[model samples]
Target: MLKGLGESLQVTLRKLRGLPVVDREALEEVLKELERALLSADVKVELVQQMLENVRQRAFKEDIPPGVSRRDYVIKIIYDELTNLLGRRYHPLTLVKRQLTKIMLVGIQGSGKTTTLAKLARYYQKRGYKVAAIAGDTFRPGAYDQLRQLLEPIGVEVYGDPNEKKSTKVVKKGLKYFEKKKIDLLLIDTAGRHKEEKGLLKEMQQIAKIAQPDEIILVIDGTIGQQAYAQADAFNRTTPVGSIIVTKLDGSSKGGGAVSAVAATGAKIRFYGDGETIEDLEEFDPVRFVANLLGLGDLQGILQRIAEATSTEQQEELMEAFKRGRITLQHFKMQLESVAEAGTLRRILSKLPGVGKGGPFSGLPVDEMDDESVKVFLAILRAMTREELENPKIIKGTRIHRIARGSGTHPDLVRALLKQFNQTQAMLKRMRKMRKQRGVPGMGGIPGMQGPPF
Candidate 1:
């Protein structure tokens, strides 16, 4: 969601890819560009310098592996360094199954802490957890109402008392209420407290003591840039923040600053809010995030999103078919349905290698296809016989006409689907060969059947 920084990085990588040779001089030029980009994005100067130093050492010293281009190797080093700058690995919320997991959210005022709490609650609720939110923001007017309005619609129960000015008392009562209900996750939204507000900070400590939260999350505003470090440090000093959530990243130009600063604090970033919607929160993954930023795409992230959009049974069936490399037309149709349900074709394509912004295939008209086209493709597949669907090679010109008639679509559309299916099969064959060469087990193919056809 750090659009500015992502675009800047992508442009720098694109220039590097065009270089005749990835020598020390080229590497130095690229690192200079990166330094400017990072500083302009408000990233901490020290972190940026450290990351560039690491990248420079590896880019010039590392031996290029067989079957890899020097340009690609340099790009890989940048990706690795940037990922490490964010966080080396993903840190998931420590929630015990079938037990109450109390998460206390603390941040400064206007940091979108209340909204983030709702997003977190919805995130857990979707995973089958019995989630309840406690609005302990006694200092903010209508904070309880705001949380209730955002949470109740999502079926997450909200526990708050506007009359109770004592935040600790509210948390204590909310904890008791959820304990009696045996809720799986209890999210406590504390009042925003600045470092200067010792009274508010002390109140946060009191609430933490009373709630005894399993995890204390500091929600920081992405617009704050490098100042996020001070905010997080102040909160950590008060209640010992275990995790961080950066909000409003979608609109913040300084998102890089906030994210990198939080990483500098040694606090794990558990989640990030990219949009205003409740479903916009996503678990932060360093590798995937950097991959997307570098225009390499995040196939794993796209697959995870697709899995979440589909049912458990559907996911299992898809995974089994993929493992066997036996993805049929029926399976392909199901995948398209899942992709449509998950997001638009443009969004899905943005996560595919060489297809996202600044990638080689970025100019493709993925945005032109809409729900109607997806439904028409599914209809054409439904019109096909079981044998033809299972063995697409059996579908000849005659079968294409018949299927088009049965599906009430143009024969050209049917032929287009077949062409797309053939392309997908070819891509899968190439992926299988690559996996074999790399000694990787399993199909190692794209989770979806095919890339979006322009």
Candidate 2:
């Protein structure tokens, strides 16, 4: 999603950094490049012009603080401007504990509304909330079946009447059904309708009146680009849309357009669907999103995930070892296991500074390894002796063969695992040395390395 835009912006930034001196002319050139990139990504013309103007004004007017390079200042200005374009802050879906929060989902047809409902259900369920979903979309064929198939596997109960044609009645009955269940969150999946469908809109209004939902979310399809504005505008006018969810962003090159267009309408984008699975939806964070676009990496998100995957004592111990510039196979194994829950290997690597495109690990094959491959690597490690685990240099040809046999893998896999381990160790050692030279302990003092606010 918006990968091309990100790459273009990265190239422009690289060019700006390579210049001997960044004058007003160079700044203008960068802005032009940025404007072109945003336009190509289907961002609204007005929004792109506004963002470029802001960048230009700030780049020309702001004084270069002492010790801060002019290139860095320009980069900061661009980042700020882009973040503003995408809504300046994160808008989380605030849920009250022990409260039955009724969330009504509305969107156009084929916008991935049903799938997003399942994802939302999984998200709340993982947070220890008693969540259930109501499939009020009786217009679409198999709407009930689809919702049931997606939600039931994740332990979220779904209520719907396939033969019931009245969406309002279905919602009313579903609400009544859950009233006695003590459900913490009830997600109502309303039928998708066009803006001009007066009959459908009236039905939606009646359903809303009956449900009295705490939040009415408008789900937008990212592939529609700027055309999403019409749907968002129409829905907001029909009933006050509390928030928005943009779906199918994973492969949509026009995702930028969808996001920017919706933001322009003043409705907060609460979440976005980045993949096909139930766990693919993520809360939209403006700062982190802009950082990834500018190739700065999501350091805050990564650190927070790491903290969540490890205990405080484990964190302190790891920090101590990192400070000492020593990372044994044991530590590596722990990190791999912990990061498995964090996200995919590519996602984790992309969040690391100097590990993304044109970064230190850009050419590394570790990003190509999936979860199963990682598990196999872990198994190979488990087959090794304590001595070999501690000192990988002792693993010879026969030792590698024996471990591979024990782990049900080939010797080449064992060698590949060792190579990856060595590469990771080397990268960590280099980072530690760089931090030491800067008089920082571990990675704490590094820019963008701070943990997220829990």
Candidate 3:
């Protein structure tokens, strides 16, 4: 996920900050380092060259406001140029004023259009918009069933023929049916195409002409590197593509392909797929994304997720328990689940101010613990009655043995879990007291802790 690139650029920035004053020579060196990092990450060479040129031109321009530090001025210019390289703002799908907004998704095969459709449906559902997905991808086996299964949980209706062979007819009927039913948004997932497949391209053009979608989203796999630019360009010539959604960013080693695609296509990236969950899709925000790309944190998004997860009443209760040295194994299990949902721990920790390559426990293997282990721990907690969760002191050896049997884990594993839970409880008590002394009232989620937007 461009992790190395971010790390390298931060090191360069730190070196620049240590210098007495920023001048042309220092700026040139910094730009050169950044260009190398971007190119190494598989960003298009042309785009990288132009971006550095923009940085240099803006840095030396007389238009820079007075009294700004040279270092700060250069950073701001770089930020602006990067933001411009990425699409500046999200483009809302504008339906022809009075009609339903119909968006047809297109891309090469294996680009994740089907899953992205469900994610987008759920997003619209959360915003109180009535959405239904049409399984227009008749070519893919199980397309109808897959959409139905994934969208059913989110309460979105799926319209398609399980045995339909005509793609255009299916989409036409699906859209007409939904339009009368008054669904606010209709997202159609078309069959993926090879860039050079003339038959597929003609079929797609027919589908578009029949449906006349208001917006077309090109789903590009982020891991493909700069080759994604060519894929997007090919699709653009075949049919109008309104925006882009970069998928598989969670595991992409070189995400610069996403950046290069944005720069080359001039299409606003609408969303980024961060994880495998239905809620893992997030709107593309330039300022926060670049900050994260440069190894800076997105504290605001973290706080927002925390606020959504924990209620005010629960926060007060948790803080009170922390202050009383009563944090239990149950609470530890809940916190672990929350962290797991937030995304990879290392990626999250990497964003904090002082946690990096040389920071404390930086050598600790990230996510070494498996999900099965987490599940086992949760099972052990579930075996506990309310009394045991609230008061760990009462669980004697006999009870521990019974708990292990009930939870289907070894007694030694149970004991080890309890020991770790105790250590975490003690740490929380200390943090709680410090916060209380500082006049903070509750266990609000830690400030400046960034994790996945999901």
Candidate 4:
């Protein structure tokens, strides 16, 4: 999600970096590009305009935050503005002190409400809560069966009438059954209904009234783009929608529209569904999400993905290098190889905030950049003398030629690889600047591991 925005914004920021820091004219131009990008991604115009204005005001405020540089100040302002626009805090499921917590899921057809119900149950179960699912979606084909198929293995109790013709009756009965069971959390998956369908809306309202849910959540398909917000607005007006869960985000969904919907409906994002796995649901963290959207990598998610892809011994070595911030080309090659097994370079990079989509090589054809080229590059690097490896600038024409001969590659190819390394160094410098601006402390080192990889 947000691959396009991330890529575009990264390029735009890189271009802005060449100019004077926080200059009035340059700031204005950058803000304009940002506005265009957000709007193009289906973000609400009001939110876009408000965010740009905040960025402008903060940039021009003149007082830099303590211990920050001028360039860092501007980046910080932009980051702060984006975070504010996304909402300052994550809103998790807050249960009442005395009564059982009830949650109702509503959305248009194909919004994945049923699956979301099971996912929610699993999420709460992980938190040590006894949860039950009431399959209120009687109209949809196999709604009960599908939800049960997903939830039954987890030992979650489900209440539903698979053969019931009337959704309202099915929902009413299900709620009563769960209520008697004394479930700590009851999640009701209502039948998907269009905003224009008044009968369905009224039926939903009846269910809501009977169920008296503590939270009303609207499930939106992330692929719907700007329409997701409109759906949220419509549902919010019909019944109180406390929050939203955007599903199918692993696909091509920009998810910018969902941010717009947050602005429109004033609903917090409770969770985001990245994939079909029950564990794919994640709690919403505005700051981390904004960082991800702006090409500032999701550090936690990256670590988790790495853990999933690496074996115990390889993971130990990788973690050691990560902590030391001094990884060898050999280790880098291994990481690249492991990530390649699960996805394409473009796909993997797109998911990373600082590396893909909107950053330096936003529009570059990463898919064409193959693993073989990376392997070849590693081979060339391996041929370099120890002094050349430690101090790259020492490798002049003669050293380059020697390295090329040793690696059995063309001199021109060696030169090209060196040039690419220089480009990557420049990109890393820019990232260090951005990270400092965002107040991500201690990029220079990590805690657990010590020293560089050999």
Best by lDDT: 2
What TM-score quantifies how close candidate 3 is to the native fold? 0.61
- Between prediction 2 and prediction 4, which has the larger TM-score? 2
Angstrom error of the Cα, residue 254, model 2: value is: 1.0
**Which pairs clash inside model 3?**
none
For residues 191-271, could you state the per-residue lDDT of candidate 3 as single tens digits?
875555465466567888988887788888888878777656655665655677888888776676565676577666778
- Can you rank all candidates by TM-score, best first? 2, 1, 3, 4
Candidate 1 residue-wise lDDT at 178? 78
lDDT of each: 0.75, 0.76, 0.69, 0.67
lDDT of 1: 0.75
- What's the CA error at residue 116 for candidate 3, in Å? 0.6
Q: TM-score per candidate, in order?
A: 0.65, 0.65, 0.61, 0.61
lDDT of 4 by residue, 1-454 (tens): 5658777776776667667656788788888888878887778777888889888877777555334455555665676677677664556676643358889888777877887888888988887788888888877788888888899999997888878877778778887787567678888888876645365466667778888878888788887776666666666666655578888767643576665566456667888887888888877766667667766552334333432434333445655654454544444444444434323323324453322112122222222356567556766877876667656778787888898999988888888876765665555556557767888774543232243211
Off by over 4 Å in 4: 14-20, 96-99, 195-200, 295-454
Task: State the lDDT of candidate 2 residue by residue for 159-262, as single tens digits.
Answer: 99998998888998999888899899999997776545465466567888999998888788899899988766666666664688999888888899988888
Give candidate 3 misplaced runs (Cα > 4 Å). Answer: 94-99, 195-200, 237-241, 295-454
Candidate 1 per-residue lDDT over residues 12-88, each given as its tens digit:
98798789888888889999999999999899999999999999888768655444566776776687688788865
Total backbone collisions for each predicted model: 0, 0, 0, 8
Lowest-scoring 10 consecutive residues by lDDT in candidate 2? 353-362
Which stretches in model 1 have alpha-carbon errors above 4 Å? Answer: 195-200, 236-241, 298-454
Residue 390 error, candidate 3, Å: 75
